[model samples]
Target: MSALPDSRYVSLTTFRRSGVAVPTPVWAAPDGGDLVVWTRADSGKVKRLRHTSRVTVAPCDVRGNLQGEAVEAQARLLPPGEWQPALAALARRYGWQWRITYGAGRLVGILRRRERRALIRISPA
Candidate 1:
């Protein structure tokens, strides 16, 4: 239904400060004309994105096994005003699995005292 990684998992490659590529598998969903992915605000990807918006994404399996070639894209961390709806869109796409995973994360967050979540918006480069 959307051009943004329709696969169950996508490998998002973000560059480090030294230009090294770091790849991570994540769940992605469509938000308006952008593709959004959720992650903790303190994540390495967030840190890397601060320095450079250039990224690449490819359909992959849950284990990060590539299923297709990657596509170049520009990524930005969305501001607070839109993260909630982006998460809702993710729930719609992933359904119960999303709830389960998010719930588990919430519990972990409670134990770890974390509430900083972020939504990353990606568009064609």
Candidate 2:
């Protein structure tokens, strides 16, 4: 497994059923040297992830440009309360408006893990 990223944001790319790339913003956490992300159980992202555990999570600059090797890793949907603090921290940091939507159903803490991927390259600003 590769080292966890050092940035707050990661570009999460999942493969669609049509075999197309679907990228989105995902909050990440370094758990026991592994990368973790939270999403709703019924979310499209989660559904796609279930199909393709292979995914990329990379650090980016303020402009949303890739900064380093988007680490490639496997993703797993974690059950609620598995990682509460991490999930809460992400909500506070991102100011997620849908926190209650997930929290209300007690569907919080659905974490995805990224195992390893090639380092992405980014030019110095």
TM-score per candidate, in order? Answer: 0.86, 0.61
Candidate 1 per-residue lDDT, tens place, 35-72, comes to: 78988889999999999999999999989999998888
Tens digit of lDDT per residue, candidate 2, span 1-125? 56656677777777888888877775564544565666545667777867767677778755557778876766766544465655555465556553664454353233334322111221111
Stretches of candidate 1 off by over 4 Å are 1-3, 107-114
Q: Least lDDT summed over 10 consecutive residues: which range in candidate 2?
A: 116-125
Candidate with maximal TM-score: 1
TM-score of 1: 0.86
| Candidate 2 wrongly placed segments (more than 4 Å) | 61-63, 84-125
Top model number, lDDT: 1
